[model samples]
Target chain A: MKNVQRIWTQGVALFGLSIIVGIAYNTTRIVSVPWIAQPIQLVNEMDRILKPVYEPSIKNISIDIAKQLVDKNIPFIDARDDEYYHEGHIPHAHSSGDLIKLTEYLDIAVGLFNPFVVYCSDDDCGSSEELAYQLQSEGFMNIYVFKGGWKEWNASGLPIEITSNE
Target chain B: MNKYIQLGIRLIVGGLFIYASIDKIVDPSEFAKQINNYHIIPFGLENAIALILPWLELFTGIGLIMGIYLEGSTIWIFLLLISFIALMGQAILRGYNIECGCGLKEGQMIGLAKIFENVIMLIALYWVIIQPKKYFIIFPKTELEE
Candidate 1:
């Protein structure tokens, strides 16, 4: 019993020390994160763009929203690697794997005014978000990130097309 | 032979923990995102955990290696390994298909292999706990008894 108490005490002390050191070291870092994360607010209006302020233009949307966009024939961008895209992808989705190449394709095939959805492997994959951000920086607007991505879409038995190996 | 074995366990576990902490300490935000991928932590508490966890790993690892607060470090190591196994197991069961956030390897997905690794470490820790004679301890357990 006494040994347990002593171990517990030491554990607490170690935790406290870690907290102190962590906070102090974080303060010294130039790219320190907030102690508490703030919720991401969706920006919908173009009026906010006029203020010369930069907010993330890409908004995360659920599978339902993605489906609605697909119904309306909004363009879909597959952000996975070329091989995965070749294996299978959402119907009529465009992908080149290379961001610059994809951007060029988007410019030639679909104008910037058209709203599009971007997706990767699944909710756990970060490539879709990353691609969306890159697209945003490249002056693309009205972008939506399909967070559920290909895994969810495929599991749901949605329409998908495979590129033929010629 | 027993003393040498104990020392080996300490070095392996301590070195592993310290190595695992470096990447997390360097990129707390990325670590937070990886933790969030598990979808277990609620109310965005992953940030707070991300901030503190690496430091704890570092300190406890140093303590284990140097034989400072040996019992406390071992206990913490046990708890951490259990937590890791549980988290990885749940992620696999739920089909989350996320990165392990282990800090040891980048893009290492959650799967049976990770859980197995943690179980091995847990077994090592058990040996440490049961060993009668602790070797090369800078601060002996007797001091805490007093």
Candidate 2:
């Protein structure tokens, strides 16, 4: 019994010592500032980790296909929410959301599909990519991602179609 | 079986912990994703956990390797393992598709395989605690002359 107790005491001491040392190491912290130091480090690291392979750029079509009111010829797909779409969209741009539910409007869009263009809020936004990928999976070809998207179009001071679905 | 074998295990496990912590400290956002996916903790605590966990791993690893505090280090490792087992169990229950975060980037989803691995390691750790002669000791060994 005494031997067992002695062993137990030793175990307790070892456990306590380990925690103290462990705590000591963790308490050491150095100020590594962002932008000045870490950002450069991360960019260099990201360059290595992000794959080199490239997917073909999705094409951008610049034409007004609705009743020929505007003199542009391209298929525009809107990748924004219903709220944004009802507020305004590039004329003749189809919503991917309604397409998912209806599935019938897909043919009308496909019928006019030459230089298909997908656009969303802006370049940094991912909705356009998601819609394009979904469309591609559904066998629609000639897809393009409008890097400029809505912000660019509005910023360019081009004509826009606005509605009050609200 | 012997002191050398125990030391070898300690070195390997400890070294891996230190190596794992380095990457996590460098890229915390990714580590935060791993912790969040487990869903054992809420979103509010995720960032704090992401910041603190790597440090815990680092200290535990360094302490074990240094062997200056074998008993403390071994127990900490044991407790860490227990916490890990619980976390993995929770992850598995919640249907998370994440690596076990065992410092391996190729961390596979927590599954029966991982549970088995943890169980085996826990047993080995228990043995180390019970039989201190098998592990590296901070105390200098008295030389025996025949």
TM-score winner: 1
Model 2 spans > 4 angstroms off: A1-166, B132-135, B139-146
Candidate 2: docking tier: incorrect
- Candidate 2 lDDT by residue in tens digits, A1-166: 6544544564566545544643454345353212111110111122222222233323433322221312344456778777787777877677666545523565464432334567787654545655665565555554556656777777767778887774
Q: Candidate 1, residues B1-146: lDDT per residue as tens digits? A: 87778888999999999999999999898788778767778888889999999999999999998988888898998899999999988878765555688999876878898999999999989988887667676775564321
- What candidate 1 gets wrong by more than 4 Å, as runs, is A42-58, A62-89, A94-116, A120-143, A148-166, B140-146
Q: lDDT of model 1 at residue B105?
A: 88
- Write model 1 residue lDDT over A1-166, tens digit each, in one string: 9878878988998999999999998999998899886644444443332233234455777776677667767779987767788999998898846668888877776556556778988977656765675687687765777888999999999888999645
Where's the lowest-lDDT run of ten residues in candidate 1 chain B? B137-146
- In the range B34-131, model 2's lDDT, one tens digit per residue, is 56545456434655566666766776677677764455556767887788889888766644434566666553557778888777777877876676
Evaluated at residue B128, the lDDT of candidate 2 is 63
lDDT at residue B90 of model 2 (Cα atoms): 72
Q: What is the fnat of candidate 1?
A: 0.53
Candidate 2 local Cα displacement, residue A62, angstroms: 34
In order of appearance, the predictions have TM-scores of 0.76, 0.47
